[model samples]
Target: PYPQHHQQRQEIFFGNGLTANYQARLRYMIARYAHYDHILAWEVFNEIDLTQAADEQLVSWTEAALDFLAEHDPYQRLRTVSWLRERWPEMLALPNLTLLQVHRYIPHLEHVGPSDSDVIAAMLSDVIHLRHAQRPFIFMEVGHHGHDDSDVPGNHLDRSGVALLQKSWAGFLLGGAGTGMSWWWDSWLEDNDLWRLYAPMQRAFSLIQWDDPGLRPMPVDLGSDMRILGWQSSRQALIWPHSRWSSWHNQLLQPGNNPHLGKRFAVTLQSMSPGRRYSQLAIHMRSGAVVAAHTLHADGHGRLQLKLPPYDGSIVLIITPQP
Candidate 1:
């Protein structure tokens, strides 16, 4: 219990007895559940930016709250918080708070909303660009547009669940800690039994060496109706190409609206060791099958050109330096 929840929680942040009660509850929760190993970091708040508490007050309260957690908890687990606006640098810059979280749901087009990958990329880019210190960012809450009261379907209302799946993949593939914990898990995904949609991420995520700190997001120049987004370290590179023509809007609302995209695509993978040979495997995202595998040697300019086999939804490409 921190001073960073909705407007109603503001009273607990200020009220004398209320604040003590909140602390007691927090301590009780820790004493009871901290023994478990599976629990992730202690999230200080869901979306503090939505709260009525002032930033200065929230910052002071958060520091004390974090100290309290460290003092009481025997495990001394990781601590973090979430923000919709990313406005509190003082809170984010706290060294003890190692993880930065944001809940993203921005819209695009008239009523089509932003594409799935676009949302992740935008949130990630915001966290990367806004933070005072380098910290791991996670999309703690994400969905098309928060499943609001609008009678009209906002951006991603696809029955196929592809929209949310794309966002999840982009979060991991674009260098996040894991897939975005989409907001509509029970109502949208679970209600429709969309758990199987994430099957492709397991194998594709395994291909990444996440411990490598040098892995950076690399730009992909594509000559097709797709955009390749991923990262590359010295030893390996992983990227996903999602068709620009087939997006949340068209695929969900207007399926097959775009003209037939070519089965083959051409692209140059940049920022690898020049004149080096690498093993490249193009895996189908939906089925997690290796559709194409080849030995690709980069030119002296550090560019490896390749052709992607025909795919419907999306594809994950894995490239590793050959010995």
Candidate 2:
């Protein structure tokens, strides 16, 4: 629960007289729970930009709070503030802030596209912009706002779930620290029985050794109708691809109009190590099914081209190295 009035909220967080009290509370929290190894990070607020406090005041307070946490927290756990995209420059610049947090709601507006491609594009844009932060960037909230539901004909229970899934995988492939956490998990995911969508993503992530220092996000071009996002290590790479024109809503509402739903394309690999060759490649669908497998070698310049199978949703490719 939050204060009803903006002024009240501002006073509690930014009041001149409350600084000592706030710092004291933070100290107490660290003292009380710092020993519990499970507590990962300390977030100052859920969405502090919504407060009526002036930008300068919020920034100053956040800096002070983060400083206090850094000094007092025994383990020096991560410090972050979930902030609006409008204030990203200010919040992300804070020296003590360790995580770049973001929130987005897909709307039915024409400009927004509200489609799978649009979602991937938006997330890629966000990761690209926040990459300067060089910290763990995450979408703390993602889903369709209920208030905007009137624009659509019926409930988006299934479509929203698929959108969340796509956003999660795309975010990870595009260099996000983790999957976009869906908003209203109780209503949008659990209540709708859509929680199973996460299982495949979890398994996909488990297959990769994320801690490898050689792995880094690499760009790929799949032409206009398709999108590819992935990362490459010294000898191995992981790629994920989805159709730009396909979305759960499009598949459900206008099936007749989408003849190219599962269109296949030959995608060329890029930015590989020169003179190195990949020994094996496997393509996996969202369900973790191995749709295709090949024992292939990269060309002399270190490029490998593969013909993809027909699939409207997302798929993963694991490129293994030579022994």
Candidate 3:
């Protein structure tokens, strides 16, 4: 808990037993960090349920805290609570709340690897309905303990992240949930044994800047063999392999079956219109001894042949459709 004074420093008064000091603390935060764009929203308590508090109590405190803040600074950006899966709806009804976010433990809770798309879709639907048609909701938490000896190393998180992204994008295109964020800030996990396993996923997810026009997803074919690398429907193209720890290769040669190498490279297009400007496609490679970049183009529809050069470490192919 933040020091009572920090909460009171703003003279905050919540109907749920908040002292004036708590409000002061929130005021101090708004006054201090409002200028920074990276701070998404002012997140309230982590898990009110864990504290043995009832939903009504949590909402009352939230109302008081938010009312105090709004009174002092009417333009507070947005508000959210870090909640467990089942309790999200109870929190979304608050009049001043902006979004409903939940932490869902996919395979971990069920003792399995990456959950299926339908399961994710169901959760997303629940989020959409619970908001009372108020604000956009998101999957604020989705992660598994990679270091757990009984668990599979990378497959769970990888598949789950991919599944969630695909389902989320499809939902948004059809108008479902708002946005999402994985558990968070993996830097601290860097030196741990599980870090190496999670590095690829972290890199892949890092490239997604939902706010940036360039990195935004767009529409494209959901090809069968090309391994549904993450795609943003807004961009209308396939997202490249940006993960550093991926199980892929940086070979510059044309993709063909080679038992000696795990790098099986291929690109497929479901449809295209010739003469229309196509996105500039490129591949990035890094070897312990050398670094390289290659660019290619996509012809109208079907599959286009891409020539790759050989390298040691990992390779990422970026498709930038031309306007």
Candidate 4:
């Protein structure tokens, strides 16, 4: 007999009902991966919302998956799912669900046409419903890509995107959404092509991580002397205080700061794994202007507090490996 049937995505088991083959597979996975502690959540599928084939069926499958996890582990595992913002509501109703993950991208201005504030509003509304009612939601993925035209405000878009997302995070703290994730193109920004592009974002989200999740934002006024900027996504966070960089007299064009413009500055370090490598700091300058920048680092760690002042900065703190 079939345990359930949801053929929304190709990942759904072929042939029989949801119970028979799919449930069996689910059990197999849990058993195979004994270290459940490391697993964040059982991501059912990516882009499954776009599949119109078996919407109801998929829901049944999700419910079954949740049941399977609950049966095996008493410590409620987050029944998480990710999809375009349009598909968030369908999964929010599931029992014992942790977060409703929504992926959003701005395809207008830079490229394509039209902005869907309506969609954004609807998504926010759903998040509001979930959070106020004690349910949780997050922007699973939020970022943008370059435009074909010259007027692409890629970094601005990313900065503003997370800023917009923080509005929901504020709501969550006030008992609204749970968490959020800011998406980025690894290659685009890593090469420093998008310095201003994602640096603010990396700094923004880093605050959440640095705060270590317990403390909420406190009210403080630095006036024009300090500027706060950041970037965040579900999996990662980054924050930077622009005042630190801008305070430098003249541009700090030390080596590694800008390889292309000469006097490029580069620092080396290692991380135990990708997860620990949270953020990075580097410097980029243009003639009379100098700025210290920070972004997420996948690997690069192990050292004392960076003494290099005109220090480009490490996105994540470098901790010495224990002997």
- Pick by TM-score: which candidate is best? 2
lDDT of 1 by residue, 1-323 (tens): 55455565665664333276768888898989998999888877667656667777677677777777777889988788776775666887676786777676645334544444345346556556533356677767766664353432543356667667777777666556677777667666766677776787788778777787778776533445667778887667888776666666566657677663656667777667889998988887767889889998888888788667765657788888788
Better of 2 and 3 by TM-score: 2
Better of 3 and 4 by TM-score: 3
Q: Give the winner by lDDT: 2 or 4.
A: 2
lDDT of each: 0.69, 0.69, 0.44, 0.42
Clashing pairs in 2: none
TM-scores of the models, in the order given: 0.82, 0.85, 0.51, 0.46
Report the lDDT of model 1 for residue 82.
74
Q: lDDT per residue, candidate 3, 61-90, as tens digits? A: 876666665566545667777665464555
Name the lDDT of candidate 2: 0.69
Off by over 4 Å in 2: 1-5, 108-117, 147-155, 220-223, 256-259, 274-285
Candidates in descending TM-score order: 2, 1, 3, 4
- Report the lDDT tens digits of candidate 2 across residue range 34-151: 8898876799877887776788788888888888888888798888888765445776789999977777666543434534335676666666777767788777777665554344
Error of 4 at 100 (Å): 1.6
> Against the true structure, candidate 1 has what lDDT?
0.69
